[model samples]
Target chain A: MTSQPEQGGGQAESLTRLTEQLSRLPGIGPRSAQRLAYHVIRAPKEETRELAEALLGVIETVRFCSICQNVTQTDPCPRCALPVEDQSIICVVEEPLDVVAIERSGAFKGRYHVLHGLLSPMDGVTPENLRIRELIERLRDDTVKEVIIATNPSMEGEVTAMYVQGLIAPLGVRVTRLARGLPSGSDLEFADAVTVARALEGRQEF
Target chain B: MSAIRVTKLSLTHFRNYAAQDFQPADGVTVLAGDNGQGKTNLLESLFILATGHSHRADTDREVIGWSAAREPIPYSRIAADVTAGDGRERVLELVMQLAPRGQAGEPTAVAERTIGPSGLRGGTLQKGYKVNGVRQRSASSVGDLAVVLAGPEEVDLFAGPPADRRRAIDSTALQTDAEYARELRRYERLVTQRNAALRDARERGSTQRTEDMRLWEQELIRAGALLLGHRITMIDVLQKEMLAAHTEFTGRTGHLALEYRSTVDIAGNGGASPDLQQSLADALEGAWGRDSATATTSVGPHRDDLRVVSGDVDLGVYGSRGQQRTAALALVIAQSAYIGQQLGDEPVILLDDPLSELDADRRERVLRHCLTPGRQVLITTADVELIPAEVRSHAAMYTVKNGRIEAA
Candidate 1:
């Protein structure tokens, strides 16, 4: 089933290994990986050395922030360290990308806690695999009032938020999910029936 | 239901047929053939073309011709030209081939024994759809062509396992209700995810109410409620039609009730959408302890049953073989009426050897039931003498021999 271009040993073996490693990345196929390898070989020496250094530099310098679990060079991410009007609010997100998405929206003014991953039971991903323990520990005090669960509306994301909500319920902190509805600039006429149904469900008062 | 009439059907490398084009008559078409001469295969292809699924085959790959490997691309196609009640003409196509788009390797099979004989390397058999030559997702093609097949296989519907019964209702809902496919898919996925959560809780030996288990349960409740609501509505429609159909076909006046025995306890067993969701939520919570212990969902639509009862005699459990066969026939006729009532266009009725078990009187009545004008019908029989003279006179007869069909 697997008909690859690797035939000989030594040079061919190393090149095949490189192609396999590169193809392991998301959206990069074996052909694209081989093309990348060829491009790297034709490039200048320092350029190749700089690419290797950049890859290593990220792994060595970057680490998950101890507070919110967002990737950062500092112990506590800048977002976690900054002061806000209300110290009693926390916006929980699934990953660092979610944090960036919410920050770009500028609609939220609370602190953020990145779970780093959603709760996927099928994949054997439990609460222990995520940053739920850290989140519960952060809620130990009565300082935080409301926790806005900014997880995506996917099934896994919904379960993860609900799990966090269940834990936070006893803590007396309020839990809320992001509203789901139609997209901006899209006509209601062209929207699919499910989208229209959800938009009607999440409709706000005029 | 929009009345659908299949004008022309073309099969290329399909099971038993290397290539065959057939034009069925408007009212009735009877396919006559001896056993194993591809009589049922014709009806099966029509079913696949109509519903995008084969009711008999365990896998869609089985429908691909064994000689399909001789073709350059190794693909099987079933295409049909249909006209609706308003005389709107359309073409629908379903193709089964190996490999995903663009990327190509060995044949696409993890372990297909049938494809193995072809000596093609491992490749996956993927099904693709086209509406009027325009690529369309299978989900978007709902209600394009509605079909009700009363085959011997579905006769076991009453005595069949829970999965088969659920699939029967789902199949009907899938073709008639346009929104049903998406909701059903969503509901199944949620059930899987919920089962995973329960299993995770059991594996971890969680002491404080398995983390995120309720969240998934809550999500499943919303989705499951929608599914239950649809099934209840579907059962109501089928119950009404089957009651009349059973009496008319069998000449028995006993009330035939199609009861949807749901796993979750909605307020009235099946209330309005909001009430149904709340009831499902309550039921899930009640079953959580057992569910977490067993690491499986205890209550959901997946565990429901469709009970076919004729005046206290549950056909699945207490009926005789003859009685079960009668009920199955009634159910198929009811499904046809239900699709017609729901879609406004009557579905194309394909009866594949349904008369073998029925006595002479009911056989003629059953054929007369489907002989309604403007409704296209296809009947496959091992012997043409079994068909009533009236039906035989009205039908455009065709003899099928070794996958070959000829007008008789």
Candidate 2:
């Protein structure tokens, strides 16, 4: 016997397609996507039309930074281009949220680069999977004084930080891990603002 | 092969279901509705059909419709039809009927679940169960059918408090191993008994009577150690799967990890098996005197947590809500894959708005990696615009409004 499609195409086919697509995104699932889709369907025409336009607009306009690979509306995100910040230190992070966390601490006046992800052999994520090459290129500049490895303290976080630090160590640029006590195996985003600030202030040479 | 498909799940006088039924398509059924729209209710019916208990913690009477009139007495029932996975041409119908309102004074209500493999009239009725159908002799004797749900509340599988995460681990492990489940229940009961005995001895001021305490401790150690051992093994398996799945789900090269945080750390000085087991026993024994004085448990796997971290950062603590959700999602998806690998039958996968907190890239990665052939995946969502393009191409859709379901 053929397994029935729980929700078939004929009934809300476009809606299902949208939900399936939405569910495929980072955090939206079938249920949320369905509710959202129906929300759009049942919503006032202008609201849904605006959402549809925004969805398309974001996809069309949003692109990763050429240098940091952070999602951006511009080629090099603000941090990559801003001249007011110290260009000597380049803070490396796994995701864009880490950038926000570091920025919230107000400790570091340096520029930032987002790697998109870390290296996990078991999960098939490797150096090639992230923006390592872009980082390497950013480091090739002679004026850069330090590279802060702000990756979380998990095994994979350490591995990524170490791998990147090792690659650029020969260049004479300082590579540092965030100071300990932020809790091992925890993400940076949820760290209390003060803890993150302290981790930033206490960075030591790797 | 036929899959058990719940086309219209309407619950009247059912727990939290004020007359609700939502229709879903075959293969990948996505139930997209707001919270409290009887979403879990729909899945509850399926769970009761498979495992014979509502995942909800409420009683049968609580599930009855309070709105029903007084004359006829309110009742509850769940109905579903399945096409056999064995490729049987006939539609299989199953109904679980609850006891009438007047008969439910006892703590446990009797119910009957009838299986009609062919037609509504010809199905066999297994009695002694009330309208709700939980077996009389053993609540679990209801059968070996299973359903697994992945929801946002499970974010703790990676970052919540230890007990929250432990329950998830124990729940899945128990579902698979009956002996493991029994041992867990026994261990919990014995821990209480041992603690009470220690308290009693202490109140009587009998330190010399510690031998009786030792006897209870012995039982505690034996049962507690067994529980810890199963947990250790489960964590080991979960770690390997989590690592592989994290990589696959993120489509990046990041290591995924799972480690059991026991009450006593593994002794670094001794060999693997003997020392670890002894340390666990010691911890459990020590907790009896020390923790009982304080009226709490301080040692054993019950205090342990399975930490899901990526790199050096815990996905639960440092990662964004989105990241934690992804980690949790990966854990469940990987568990399903592992279950499929270990047990040839791919268990039905239930995802309740799994992608609600994720961004676009991570969402697509989950679908591409997690949902595959021979697996029945049920997904629910609230936004149609957030879906990625590829996923939209493959799934069938439906709409649910005010508990009524129809093909969209």
Candidate 3:
């Protein structure tokens, strides 16, 4: 019984191929992959074709912006290509997804620089692996007066932000970080003591 | 009074038990069996379920059944149907799977295997915990089942090294207070990361090592202060209860005291005042030179000890074997009382061959204290005669044999 192949292996070649590829995705498990394969099989041909085209299209067309290193079809991403309203400020982030998040808030109309990754020495992700050189090169022009480090509030994220701050500060650019504290709509009772303490310490007057 | 009780316990591939289910009685449940008949294993299953780690076994793989050794992915699970203090029933389950050593693509496995090297022929142990079928941190699941285990090795707690005493206090505090558990985890992680940073500095002789060390020290001080604060507060509470318990059990005129001994000077305006965090931070800063030279943290709660004393004579150092055992029992009993008072729920007491070392009178005293009304207790023994006739008569008795538990 241990030596026998799976019962449906012979008849499920296409399904198996699709499931294997789906399972390789970030959040899709083997069971979810199988479910997704079945979904694709039952869906209309046009829907599956569109899905396949969108996946391939991303890989075929998307390239990192020459200036900010954010994924974009144009050499300079739209954020960098836009007339810089706040040319003196550049908000640095850890990933292109973070750029989307910050942009969604519309709180900052300044330029953006994507690091692509954070500095995690334990995971062999260093400043060399990230686009730190590119960020420093942008800072060398000295047009940006305030570089806002908007990395995630995590150990690796903080370390990367600090490393970038150290590099950019030598170029006379004032470096700042996003405030760390409690999230909005979260009760103080539910928040952990550390977050509460930080929130209290970083409190501001209305 | 409300109490957490185990309504049902089931084990699969755990220790000597291939598969066993037990419905322990509310007041007192006695497990009678000969040695090596899975008697202690039954108590151990309850302990692991409550604490998320084994009290007897050195490694989780040691708890996996021998028959499972040949399987590709050997695993063991212990599940309990626990009724919390509010009468809400939740199933707390702990599953430990043995994976092939050096397996990649699993980061959780990396942290779980920090218990030195695995002895199970290249099988690494990975544990998963669930409360009411929802995946959760093992430490968080401890809130579901609180247990105070008084076993043979507990006697060593008073007489043995500081680590044993620390474990006793930390485990009990962890079950009762969730914040303490989280701080302990954060403190441990910070220590590991700081040590790695120290090692990296030593290897490279980096000039920025001091700056890096300072940053790590600040974070460590923050986490360490919380841990030290919790441990000291817990020790104060345990001290009072332990004194009460010692007097009740031994009926001795001598006074019993518990002191929280720390490497850092937590005296005067230190631990007792608002300057506790400042004191800890100052101590870390002062020790930076020495710590940098040694490449290890020199002062913190990790280096602290719980000193048990009777009229100025330390029980850990000067007490006789029996006296030490009694002190250990008193401490365990105090922990149970402490948990009961703090959580408004009495923790289930597990006595694993606790009477074997005590004299008849002392054993009776221990049993009387444990068998008090409104408390759930489980006692495992090789000889049924060791249990008092009064307890034997009122208690539900089960005989464990060959990995099976049957009502006697």
Candidate 4:
């Protein structure tokens, strides 16, 4: 029953290799990786081919936008290439995902500049590691009147925003943060004290 | 006054308790048990539900039962069903699980391990909080089930370090005022980050360190001023109540006073006045040289202390044991009253063998004060007689043995 080890070893090795590769992705554990590998093994040949092609296509074509550091297929992301209707305001974000989130809101018509990461000294993420140089260079044109820091509300994010604010303040551009709102449908009683206090502070006359 | 009570409490894998359920009475609920029979554990579970932290144990792992620790996926949970002053019922739950450590720089062996269906592979711990079955931050869960715990540790309020006194006052303030809690949390984060930045600046000796330190100082002053303002106001209210409580309990003719000794001179500008922020900023700026040398943010509310005095003598330094205990008790009682006055709700009081350190007369006074009408009181004692007869007659008593509780 245990004979034919040489015959079975090739396929087992491939499955093991796929599982190991999948496990290297963030949030994918070994068990999840194994399950995904087995699913892929059972998936249609065309589907697997398509998945592999998509992964390779992304690696080959996608690049950071030269203007805003956002991951994009074009040199200047679509947002940067837009007409100069709101050339006076540029919203700064920590990552391309943040740009997507803001775009989903549809409330902001201004352009965006993605920093790609926050300033985390403990993590050795210094200001030099981020896209701050490009941000300051964009401000040197004197056309941007407002720089909105839309970084996530975290310690490192706040530090990065403040650091960028301090850098651009001398350039005569007003800096603002995205208003923190009470999450919709959340009970005022259940919201954290900070969020509740901020919501009250920023309340509008309904 | 609105009455806040814990209607039901359930514990699983918590200290000394494999599984236990308790339905506390509206009035006095007595937990009578021998030593190590989970009496304190029962009280601690309720306290944890209210405060999102344990009074005795520093880490959640310490609160997990030994037998539970032997399980494949070791975890401890404390849940309570509480009725707010408005009669709205809510469930607060805290689950602490042992997991592999995920902090950076840790050895790869101690890093995130595959949490299989079987069990966790590492021994580090993490805690999760839930309110009404919905996940929430620990701080946000506070005040949902307001509680005032007076264990034997209360006696150390006056005698213990200033940090303890600050914590006692901060805990009460956080429960009463949401604004104060927000400011306090922000101030704590500012202090930690500022300290880290200070250490980094000192190590690098960069020219930008001065400007960076100045920016942090400005933020610190803003946050620290708010914290100082809240603490000062709270101490003022607590001082009056504490004095009254001490007078009622001791009947001795000495003035009890509570003073907030802030690192910054709040009195000069009348306590967090418009000018106080500037004053604090200036003070922090002046301290930058020393802070840089020390590699720590040294001047802020973090270094402040609460001073308890009687007849101009500092209680922490000069008071006798009995005097210290009475002062501590007075502070606890005053805190309950303060909460009632501020929040319009009387917090549920949990007393764990507090009568042990007091004389019979003092014990009777404490029992009367705690068993105030409409306020829920849960007391744990080994001897039933330790509780005054008047309160005992009205109390719903239970006996705890071998980590089990039943009606007595």
Listed in order, each prediction's TM-score against the native is 0.75, 0.53, 0.75, 0.81
Estimate candidate 1's alpha-carbon lDDT, on a 0 to 1 scale: 0.79
List the DockQ of the predictions in order: 0.20, 0.01, 0.07, 0.13
CAPRI tier of model 4: incorrect
Interface alpha-carbon RMSD, every candidate: 7.0, 22.1, 9.3, 9.1
Off by over 4 Å in 4: A1-64, A72-89, A105-110, A120-126, A142-145, A154-159, A174-176, A182-197, A203-206, B60-77, B84-138, B141-144, B207-210, B269-274
What candidate 3 gets wrong by more than 4 Å, as runs, is A1-137, A140-206, B56-58, B61-74, B98-126, B206-209, B270-274
Model 3 over residues B90-151: C-alpha lDDT tens digits? 98888888664445223222222222233333345788877777666343455578999988
Task: At residue B88, give the lDDT of candidate 2.
Answer: 27
Ranking of all candidate structures by their DockQ, best first: 1, 4, 3, 2
Looking only at chain A, give the TM-score of model 4 against the true structure.
Answer: 0.85
Worst 10 residues of 4 chain A by lDDT: A1-10
lDDT of 1 by residue, B1-408 (tens): 347999999988787888899999998999998888888888888788766677764656667786676554567898899888888888989997755223454332222222454334234567787778766545335567888888887776788787878877787888887667776777788788777877776676773565466566667777788888888877888888888877887786887788888777744644544478887887787887788788788788888888888778888999888778778888888888888887789999988888888899888778888888888999998888999888888889999988888998
> Candidate 4's error at A203, in angstroms?
4.4
Better of 1 and 2 by DockQ: 1
Native contacts recovered, each model = 0.32, 0.00, 0.00, 0.04
The runs of at least 3 residues in candidate 2 whose Cα sits more than 4 Å from the true structure, single-residue gaps closed, are A1-206, B1-12, B18-24, B44-137, B140-143, B206-216, B265-269, B275-277, B388-394
Chain B TM-score of candidate 2 stands at: 0.76
lDDT of 1 at A149: 94
The sequence of per-residue lDDT tens digits that candidate 1 reaches over residues A1-206 is: 33443423455677777777886775455556777887888899899999999999999999998988899988887777888767888999988888888889988888889998888878878788999899999999888989999898876787787788888999888898888878899776656666777789999988
TM-score of 4: 0.81
* Residues B219-261, model 4: lDDT tens digits: 7788888877777778888999999899888976568889888
Where is model 1 chain B poorest over a 10-residue stretch in terms of lDDT? B105-114
Best by TM-score: 4
Question: Could you tell me how far off, in angstroms, the CA of residue A161 lies in candidate 3 after the best superposition?
Answer: 5.0
